[model samples]
Target chain A: MYQKSPTQEWTSNVVRYKKFSGSWAWLLHRITGLGLTAYILVHINTLASLQEGPEAFNAKMQVFMQPHWIFAAWILFGLVLYHTLNGIRIVIIDFGKGAKYHKQLLYGAVVIGLIVFLWMGYIMFFGHAEYDFLSMIVTSYN
Target chain B: MSYKYIGSRGSGSMSWFLQRISGIVLVFVMVGHFILMHYNPEMGHSFNRVFERMQNPYYQMLQIAFVVLALYHGLQGVWNIYRDFKFPSWLNMAVLAILIVVGVGFGALGIANILHF
Candidate 1:
């Protein structure tokens, strides 16, 4: 008879290495990938509303344009940005192109990802605000 | 634990290759989608605007390709993560079935919508 190990459970193994950057990245990648997949399903279904004509689709768009939904959209944007940047790093690493500078590549990706995230947040909030400063300057020139 | 054969051996390599290819394709399609739909939401979120864009043959083709590629890439990614966990054979089979059903169902819906437009 074969004997089972105490650490054989998936949860235990996941818990053990949860703190490492690599592990955290792996976990987040899976999570965000799953989230994106779910979003794709919802996205397609929502688009299907187009078949019903413009009114129905516009109504759905209005719902999506609500504040909470807009917040969720920003979150989705951040997730995609991170995933895409990290995915490029991963692809490069896979090709043995950046074997020596893997850690630097990851750090670079994180830095870039952070900048994009904050920039996106700024655009989402301040850029669209009533007193929109950036647009004010641009329109003033016009 | 004993294992059951789900399919032919060496399928992992095929999935890995397809994932990379799809990922490359998605980089372009998804980025275009983000710029169009999010960065310029004024036009994208409007039904008439989207309907007008969808009327273009090139845009329709892009949407179809994006739908198919994204579905394949995402489903394969889920399977890859599941494989890492080394789930029991039955559970693996179950997850595979679920991914297939969901992926195909959603992909079909997306393609149908594009065709209808």
Candidate 2:
């Protein structure tokens, strides 16, 4: 239960709230959910270029293939990965006896999410023929 | 008299169940999507590749279904979050209408893109 003094304001109340780990998970899930939903709308609009023929579509796709865009896409994948993993945890909690071990489930999700995120980053950015700079970094380090 | 929107939904058992079901389905689809689209960035990023893939009627159908299901799930999730706060019933109804309109509008756009090939 949150008590707000007359001067405290809603933002201050939230800023002062003592958040547990689960609260962070809950908040992140909501933030990512809303963001992904908005993104899907834009994604559909972007795909509408398909009707304009190959020249038009390829031009647009080429822009996205740039390194900056790839970086952005990789971040988007991270959010999607978190949402998907946590979603499974939620289902387990609701349908099975996971409530008792919910914290463990959250930990498991984070661990797995981090590993996959790194793996995906490798796939997206590292050891790339097109990304000569990235490949150069790897070789130079080796 | 406040119509008490909470009671009208009957605990939202159906939406909750549907949300779980949709989430489960999305996990599988997302795996395939990532593998197919990002495995070789060219596999999905290029117009030629996408055009070729869209030639398959079955792929087109599946993609259309993916669009519909994704929009439905996302919008429903948003509505769930919206419901957590205390808003008047009129505002709630207005938001529901806007979400439906957005889903339908973008759904049509997505389907049209997939089917264009």
Candidate 3:
């Protein structure tokens, strides 16, 4: 058995965890930003292809609608949810919400990210576009 | 801005600026994108509609501009994240060079795809 003092071990772990948390937040933000940006490039360019004809447009659209792209879509969607929620958390912290409240807000951000990610997952998987706000009223309970 | 209050305008400052600018652009782009893709997807999603839009010289120009800006902004943000890790200076520069090359290469391919189509 490793016989390190518990107090020393605990303190070291706390410092390590703190470093990890900050790095994790920074890393997630960067990754999400990149994914979202790639999506933007593909999106605008693909839309630009509409100039060719419906056949060309459908071919491009099919690429995006494929299974692999759908998976990428979910991942990018989740990243967006996390990045935006965590960004708002950072903004709150920046505005002088300090000490205990800041940590509390960070936890709140994680919860919000999870919720939004689940919603996105459901929508992406469903294939139907009913999840869009305006579409629901017209399609359902009319 | 005072030196103490203002942050270093080195890599960090540049990265910060790029992220903010790109994020702002995305807000407009994302909303427009979703509307075009999902709202009346059947109509707007057609290639002919896309061709019509791109056929407009102004839209074509804007599309090119948008691609360049998006790639620059995103790659810069990624570079900033990579820089956050303390690495050897040479390694940092190499990584940066690679990112630049890849970004530009992708941008070219994307442009070609749009133009040729």
Local accuracy by lDDT, each model: 0.79, 0.87, 0.64
Query: Which clashing pairs does model 2 show?
Result: none
Ranking by TM-score: 2, 1, 3
> How displaced is residue B74 in candidate 2, in Å?
0.6
Candidate 3 residue lDDT tens string, B1-117: 443322223546556655666556655665565446544545444566666676777766766766777788677767766655666666766777788897887788667756754
Say which docking band candidate 1 falls in: medium
Poorest lDDT segment (10 consecutive residues) of candidate 3 chain B: B1-10
lDDT at position A4, candidate 1: 52
Residues A30-99, candidate 1, lDDT per residue (tens digit)?
7888888878888888889988998898888887766567678889998888778778877887876776
DockQ for candidate 2: 0.81
Over B79-110, each residue of candidate 1 has an lDDT whose tens digit, in order, gives 78777666678887788899899888898899
The residue ranges of model 1 lying beyond 4 angstroms of the native Cα positions read A1-19, A128-142, B1-3
The model with the greater DockQ, 1 or 2, is 2
**CA lDDT for candidate 3:** 0.64
Q: State the lDDT at A127 in candidate 3.
A: 44
- DockQ for each numbered candidate: 0.66, 0.81, 0.34
Candidate 1 achieves a global lDDT of 0.79
Please report the candidate that would top DockQ against the real structure: 2
CAPRI category for model 3: acceptable
**Over the stretch B25-107, how does candidate 2's per-residue lDDT look in tens digits?**
99998899999998788888788888888889998888888899899999999999988888888788788889989998999
Question: After aligning candidate 2 to the native by TM-score, how far in Å is the CA of A35 from where it should be?
Answer: 0.8
Q: Residues A1-142, candidate 3: write the lDDT tens digits.
A: 9787999898888777755455677667777777876676566556555556677669888666544565576786677667666665555554455434766776777887788677656655554563343344345457
